[model samples]
Target: MQFSADTMFPGDLFEAATRFAADTLAAGDRANAWQQAVAMGWPALLVDEARGGAGGTLADLGAVIEGCARHPVGLPLVRRCAQAPALLMAAGSAGADDTLRALCAGQVDLDVVDAPALTVTALADGGVRLDGVLEGVDAALPFTHVLVSAGALLLLVPQDALPAPTARFVGIDGAQIADRVLSGLLLPASAVLQRGEAASSAAAIAQDLAIFATTLDMAATLGATIEQCIAYLSTRVQFGVALATFQVLRHKVVEMYVDYESASVLLARLVADTVVTGRLAARDVALCKLYLNELARRGAEASIQLHGGMGLTAELPAGRLARRLLCAGFAQGDRLTQLARLATEPTAARL
Candidate 1:
């Protein structure tokens, strides 16, 4: 499963994803494919060797995600593989050990949906409580645990204890969107990842990891969108000529390439910096998430438009690819919110 630097074309990643997708479609086992992927060491690749991971770099993990996106893997690889581990590491908790082990062993399915708090629901000496609902939780369905952040406090709650499931909505990917009522879910002292954070070192790590995960997700979508466009243009014909041969179509395809390349380079640079500095700014991370996610969405939309009717059908892979990209756009944070945060934050210039 190793890729040589020279042989690691985006096409290679696409082919791997396509093969996985074909197998999933043939077996009618989207969940199984995701399980197999996890068991084959996808999660372990994101954790450091000390934390039961394979010690792979962020770029390496991004490549795996890129490959997985080419097919319908049915698992949130970016969040589980990249975000959760980084958050645990930053939180400095042995409590996360069980969760981490389960993740590496493919024994647990975890999903996180965090939002800024609107009101103080509960207050205690050592812990505070949140009562707001987060927008995207469907991909986290059957999630073992849900991670919640309010102010500087981060809480981990068993999914079953959530107040209500009435907040659920349908996501772009057709998964259940998680919108749950917090009400008064009690958070114990042990549940908090960080308390009263003035951007503690551990909290910083978690934030950076979250940002890293979003960037990787963008990379995955970019890879898939590019591949779909290529496939569509190759087989689709127009006016006794290939659609790819038209000057307009050629320009669109090249634009897709440029978008993918720019996102890829940004991801690579972010990964390298994370390894070297072990820290990245929240604003910069938001910018990356904003730009990359938007780029991916645009790329997918362009691919669909170019492919015409077939692009919207379930029988065509481009449809699925587009759905996944759209879903990823709202996974970590909404694009508008991220953009606004980036614009208003003093760190905007620094990033």
Candidate 2:
């Protein structure tokens, strides 16, 4: 479906998320706020209507994520919204239907493991002998079930079967990270998402989902960084006058703005292309993902430098935001890896 700029703004969704964040911040229930944003409706929005999704386009998902990032919402909206749906689609399973509905209705938490190495991870072993520790399983702690994949096999595993520990580390974005170990976790035959070449399917889905998830992440970082740069230039003073008055600083701000706009445009176009063409627009998607993510990373660094000491402190959100963006930029696949994939793909090279 074609998305007009107006509808794509997702004004209602943005306002709801903003209000939710504000209330959560006031109540000191930040985690709940994040959960509400995801479970209340975002995941279902990305799924196809037949699968109990809201039938929203990728652009719509991007708009929701951008809005959430502008606030303090901590849930991994991009991963849940984009990755989960892509996994369900790739697996050709309606099994996620009830789960998606529950997610939309705020009745359950949804999480997915994109880690290729996780042995008992979702879709690992085609739902057979589960093994492997998955890294970066977003919101895994609260999730009832997780979609795990290794290559092409996708498996949905109940959380109770996995090993859990009580240590918590703060991620780059101030989100809690928990370490998990799975030792010979077994899955029933019914649990496996049966498909051919489980590894290849898992890899392709991971790459596709990474492109979608990381691109939106870049968009969020772009939005947050732009806001920070604008705020910095407007308030900071240098020399005898305001930094805004300096031509060099002004040029730098302009550069950041350009990067932000370019990334935004690229995100919009990538979503549109993905929606229209079901096949992997692997090259174009990679190009957009690499460019925008790297742009956001550089923009964050520039914002930090421009803001001076204040930027580095936890009191100011720029540093934290930058760290989060940087982590996300390198999260799914780093720029070098993405570029390498593109270079090696004969079809990508020709295009």
Candidate 3:
């Protein structure tokens, strides 16, 4: 039942993604990075094939993520971007088709309602009222539209229709997090994406996909960080030939490698299971998220600590990995939130 990475990424997708990541990752320029990703057609990774996208699977996206791990863009790009298009494809409506085209063309970005600062209210005449302040929006790209969830119902609201952003929070890597108060902004009936049962169902599907994609991306990023750490430890000299010669540092590297492999195996199995079932294995996703978060933190901290005084320096890749790992926790749900969900799942199912 064990699945290898080759079983998931079957073509040049891996090579293309790796080359793209290598060229653009950690460039410290969002505009340049986004343009490169668009050129590679990565933003449309999961859009339906008929929609002018590459029409690839989650595994393809996983390969791109793995390749980009040495230098990551953002979780939302894989999570929300991929998830939104999938939902639009599912809607199979005229509006969805238009949005799908825009998304695949890399003309707009999508937002997830993770922080819940905005409130959606049903208005008479079939319109909806959105109020309250939305905070912690991971808006790295200049978005043309946003997907907002109201009462678990997915609603597509044009960015122009929403209130202007009044404040912003910037990440250590220069990513922008927008905060805005939507004061009684009214969306027409046409903005209704999924309502009633269909609305919640689409939300669940998108959320599940986001969780699964984020887990694989985390594994890839951490795995690359571990490799870099091992190389540094094996070459840097101490009182002896190299730091790798030390049994303690060697043990640390081995443990971190094993952890990375374990996470990778778990992710592969989940991918296989999803492909086979045509549905998300929620219990497993929760476990993978919880398990990988701890691994990412430990691996990053260890990489930095093992690198000695130069570890935390900006020039060192270890510091960058550590910083990224620390920053990405809140993107989906944080580790604590994921852990609580995992605690309720059957122990046997997580395997």
Candidate 4:
């Protein structure tokens, strides 16, 4: 079935994403979209075909991520595609396993648990235990088993395995956010996806990619929002003339475009470096993410200002972009955290 939407698409491949996001994703065919995404070879984009994946590359995944961003789809394609395969490879376990096939087949969704507040313990049974709280966890949600992070190790946990959350809050973009106290939860040795150096390595790499993807998607949304803002201003009339005729509004749009392009180039370079070198390129990714996060916030503010009063309401795209701008910056690491991370990286220099 072909997906369709009432909105004007950005054209070419972007139209498919816009239609898919608006009609399939936004309409809440989440499970079906998961299946469709996998069927479309999204989850397999980063995996080797020998391991039941496409063996494409990170650059391919970046393109998919950019498409999703332009339309703001809610699928967990990043976790399924980049993070899972990267972690599996890091953990030394991507050898045509059933898990990998299942992932490629879209039968499962794996999520990384990189919550800020967490603790881990070793179980006497050669297993591991997780304690403390995980805040703002949006995945590993209800009704499905998912792989999660427990300190340096990865664990396959049932959704029903954990107790009820201690607190729940709605994301600014309407995503489900919760703080769960994960005490007394234990997993056997088989549940541990990685340990020691492998675990840390997998986490650093996967987390960096995940953060990169998130920030880039935010940037794409900024692009679409800018387009919408410009479109609105061109037709909107004030004082018996089009708002776009105003020099002040035109300057704001130009500023937003400059910021957007700057972030886009940085993110593209980071993606290319990761793909070509097959390394985290952590410092570069962090810098790009930091810049994009700030850009999203600044661009959203500018778009809202240019769009006038209705910009504050959900009825307008500006409000949604604003919410995404506000949230995505902190969802990954904020600018200060990135700066500190950069400072600690070995041989850090040259901004």
Q: By how many angstroms RMSD does model 4 differ from the true structure?
A: 4.7
User: What are the per-residue Cα lDDT tens digits for candidate 4 across 52-115?
Assistant: 7888766676667667765555566556667766666556653315566777666666655565
Residue 148, candidate 4: Cα error in Å is 2.7
lDDT of 3 by residue, 1-351 (tens): 111222234358777766666666545566677666766677787776788778777777777777666565553565545667667766656766777787778776666554344577899978788888767655666566677766655678777876767888877644577877888888888888667766666665667677777777778777777767877876788896888788998788778888888888878776776666666666777777788788888887888779987877767766777777766555567888887777775544311
Point out where model 3 deviates above 4 Å. Answer: 1-11, 26-28, 73-76, 90-94, 115-117, 172-174, 343-351
C-alpha lDDT of candidate 1 relative to the true structure: 0.65
| Residues 75-143, model 2: lDDT tens digits | 677566777666656555455455556556666565776656655344444446655566555442377
Better of 1 and 3 by TM-score: 3
Could you estimate the TM-score for every candidate?
A: 0.80, 0.84, 0.87, 0.86
| Candidate 1 C-alpha error for residue 186, in Å | 3.4
Give the TM-score comparing model 4 with the true structure, all chains together.
0.86
List where candidate 1 sits over 4 angstroms from the true fold. Answer: 1-22, 97-108, 118-135, 139-141, 198-207, 344-351
Each model's backbone clash number: 3, 18, 0, 0
Off by more than 4 A, model 4:
1-15, 25-32, 94-98, 115-117, 139-143, 347-351
lDDT winner between candidates 3 and 4: 3
TM-score attained by model 1: 0.80
Clash count, predicted structure 4: 0
